[model samples]
Target chain A: MNGKEFWIYLAILAGSTYLIRAIPFAAVQKKISNVYVRSFLYYIPYTVLSAMTFPAALYATGNVVSAAAGLGVGMVFAVMKKGLTVVALISCVTVFVTDLILKQGI
Target chain B: MKQFLRGVRNGVPIGLGYLSVSFTFGIMAVSAGFSWWQAVLISMTTLTSAGQLAGINIMTVPGQYAEMLISQLTINIRYSFMSVSLSQLTTAEFKGIKRWLLGFFMTDEIFAVAACQREVSTKFFAGLAVMPYIGWTLGTLAGSLLGNVLPESVMNALCIAIYGMFVAIVAPDAKESRSLLAVVAVSVGLSCLFYYTPILKELSSGLAISVCAVVAALLGAFLFPVKEEASHER
Candidate 1:
């Protein structure tokens, strides 16, 4: 917590983080050719995205109801292939309004 | 140059999302007693939400170097998997120094975008990474300097936008492929299971996410292996 400790801590954290990220690239120098390995890598994105999204999305906002509404709206737009910004804004607005409505009813 | 511009354009929303989230982080950092420069520096160096927050928590407690190291290692090790996966898609010439530089900005958003591409160009990845990086740093600076200027209502609402964007990224693919749908379901199911189950609920978020993703992805690979022609298909 002093200036010196802060810098040192940040360095360690950053250094480790950088190493963790960069090591994989250094190790996996060439493109993978194995069928199963290739398939696993290809599926990584979607699965990671899914794992990060659900339940978290429903709890991201202040209330479950508003977050769910926002998620539904966001998914609708996303499925329709709306732009990222559009989906983001609309979903936020949906949550905002839903929260407002829920607040007033209470 | 064109690819770079396209990356920046695609990065616009991610930058916006980072601006708000890091702004929140900045407020938290300031409250946690970090000076403006320190808060900005942390954001610049770490570029990860969970790791930096946990780091800040550890910093407050003091003398928990081991704890801090373990926290960061566990929280961020997923990036290694992402980088390895991305390396397979990147050009063979994208090695040495270029790989190190690219690795710096391989945040989840950037990786998601870059990995979706047919060809991962260094130029495009650079452009994609820069916007969010600047947004993250500047947002931290603004938050630390300005404090909580935004209305509470707005900030609360904005919390879900980034998640919305994530849904936006994956929904299309899940719709197109049954295998992808199965993977999504499995991941969500496992995540929920981890979250709700009494004992498993104690598991760290990083580990839970990694387990869910890896397990679901392996199942997907086995159940629905990409055809030779469609292996590289986005």
Candidate 2:
């Protein structure tokens, strides 16, 4: 919304995020006994990253084609276990090149 | 001093990683109508890419405070688990304001690095957290400010960097673990379903993502459970 609302929303988000991490650090003294919970937590990072990546990445570029190209190059780099910065730079550059090509119609 | 320096050194790569992603976030934030200062402030306050993006998405629609809270809570809930896991590794003597401060800065990258250690010190963790914090905030500042001057085409393409970062994070794990591969496929498939299906597509992106991630993760846990491993420090 407005300026006030934005700050308030940020505050709510920051406070909630703070509580999420702080409560565990403040309260959880021992390793979790629950294997199910541990396993679930273990998988959260991978699944969440994947969920965020797929469709969202497709839409991030100017068009789906360029985005797909970027994604392809990115996946290739990632599967090869390239560093994060290298993968990101190559993907973005690929998207830029693909976008230019698609626009020029050459 | 050495421990803190080691933490700082270890955090350098993470900080560099954050720089690129938060730069993309900066552009997203400005495009969504937030000022550069506001974008940087959000990064400074939250230090969470997913939660901040979700919050920004909620902001775009307006009048969805409850949705904002739920989205942030769900997206950030993983950090709670990470904190719990890291707590087991932290020194028992660490507590009070220091604990709170470190906890606030315990982001995904920080936790991943810190957790790998046999033991963690407050100084080391602080050093580890500060570099990334500065990197994230500065990157947002650079993005929000520089993004305004950049051409539309360049900015659009640059946005792919964030996505690339996410893929880089997950692809290695998926390649190594069949269970993680399944989890990635399930999450991606569910996300696509949510995006394409008429009724499911009605859900906000934040909610859709959380649902996909949670469901896929639960299924993965059931199908391929992680065997318990002995801890070096605990």
Candidate 3:
């Protein structure tokens, strides 16, 4: 892709993304007062994170086995109260080693 | 300045997590034949994983600009929900420019950390956004320049790093609160249902995530409504 058309498409991509994000900031300047609505809003970050994790995490590597291995290790570290970076690095390392060992046919 | 530094401290981990994820994106965009600078540009401007991934596909073919707009909108719509939630968390401190700037940079991990805070000051959010933005762009630079030299196993392993960060963020809280646990379970279940069922599986990832999140949140709000004093507020 090149020329004016390419940049135009790029603008479309960037502009739409920016608008989707920026509109809410521009629109919702006040805290919501309803208990149910507030609670739902409060719960969104967690639910969104959770929905993004499972099944997707299981498919993140060469195969579900290694991915699940990483997820299992991640769960252990998370349960141990490790911070975000630690859990992520540990999980990455686990998948790395598991994939390596599996590759070695041992 | 102290608060800004604290935000930076909190953001460093998110920045580190972003490196692996954006490294993957960098490798992908380069391997797909886009210029390294173009890959970096996409990362810098878009600041989204799923959306950028979709945009790469859209841009690969010439004259797919219509698809470009549609895919970006479909893939990134989740940010609207996140931003609305974040608006409630922000204090009166953020003004037009800061909020607009922050909106441009908002990503999943940044939202996770920022929304957890009792107050989100402009400087703090700015501090939090900086490293992830830098790491994202630099990681793309590295990946496009060096991804093939890196082993496939390592790349595959690194791909899981962001998901690991998600687990890290969500697990401890779920462990503490039964309501949160229920919400997580419901979301995971719906995610699987959407992933595996024939018709349901056809839903785009952005839409699927939004549906699962909204449904799970509804479960929590209706079943275990939080006290007004309980949720984060300034």
Candidate 4:
């Protein structure tokens, strides 16, 4: 798209995104006392993060075997309390190395 | 100065993480026939992964406004949950424009940073949001402009950036909470089931991931409940 069209598209996107984010704030500007809603909100982050991260990490490889290898190593490091950088590096390395070793019949 | 530096420090890893993933988005946009500026503009405005990806899909299938809206809403519907959770954390005095503005930039990383803070000041959260916001937008712009010059191999590798960011977010928390161990376990297990099971493998990647995550977390919470002390603050 040209510059004018690009700006227009950006405007549309920015407007929509802002609206999606703004609606929740608008709704809950007042205190929400519902026990069930509060409890549900409490677990939202873990659920959201888990949903967002797990599948990609496990199925990084199209096949289950490779994916399991990567996820297995990742979970081990994650359980060990390795920080983000380390867990990521270890997972990627594990996937890469496993693929390499399996390829080489080692 | 201290607070500003803290924001920057908190943002560095997020910034670094965004650089690679946003760069990939940049490349994807351009390769899909969008101009560099068009790609950059999307990044600048949306500053979201699912939104931007949906944008690309819309661009490819122009004239499908309804379809685009549905796709975008489905992907971003989760943000509402994040917003609700964060709304509770904000002080009563933080109502009005400030809350609205800060709420705009509430991505997962930004939320994690804010949630983990000892004091969730509006100013500090805004500062933190600003750092990553600027980094992500600029990174996308730069990547779009430069993607043509980069090799396919390098771009492929950069595809892993989002995974890196997830690692960073979960790693620190997993260290603090023994309960999180089950969270990780269930997620991996469910993810494996989805991938390996023939019937379920037909599901879309995004939906599959979302289902696995939510179910696994719920199950994990039940099986290995967080002790009262840790649950108190969380």
Model 3 misplaced regions, further than 4 Å = none
Better of 1 and 4 by DockQ: 1
The parts of candidate 1 lying over 4 Å away from their true place are: none
Candidate 2: interface RMSD equals: 3.5
Per-prediction DockQ: 0.78, 0.56, 0.79, 0.33
* DockQ sort, best first: 3, 1, 2, 4
In candidate 1, which residue pairs clash? none
- Candidate 2 at A15: error in angstroms? 1.7
lDDT, candidate 3, residue B78? 81
Scored against the true structure, residue B159 in model 1 reaches a CA lDDT of: 86
Candidate 4 vs. truth: CA RMSD?
4.1
lDDT by residue (tens digit), candidate 3, B1-234: 987888888888788778878888898998887888888888888888888888888787888877788878777878898998899888798857778878997788899989878888988888888888888988988988888667788878988888888888888888888888998999999999999999999888987998899999999999999887767432
> What are the per-residue Cα lDDT tens digits for candidate 2 across B1-234?
998898898777677667767988998999999888889989998898878988888988777889888888867776776676677667866777788878999886787667657778898898888778888998899999987566778777777876776777778767877777888899999999999999999876756776887899789778887766633421
Across residues B107-158, which tens digit of lDDT does each residue of candidate 4 receive?
Answer: 8777765655544566667678766787788778877888756654344334
Please count the clashing residue pairs in each candidate, in the order shown.
0, 0, 0, 1
Instruction: Report the error of model 2 at residue B5, Å.
Output: 5.9
The fnat score for candidate 2 comes to 0.79
Better of 2 and 4 by DockQ: 2
Candidate 2's displacement at residue B162, Å, is 2.2
CAPRI quality level assigned to candidate 1 from its DockQ score: medium
TM-score of chain A of each: 0.91, 0.80, 0.94, 0.72
Scored by CA lDDT, what does every candidate get? Answer: 0.86, 0.80, 0.86, 0.65
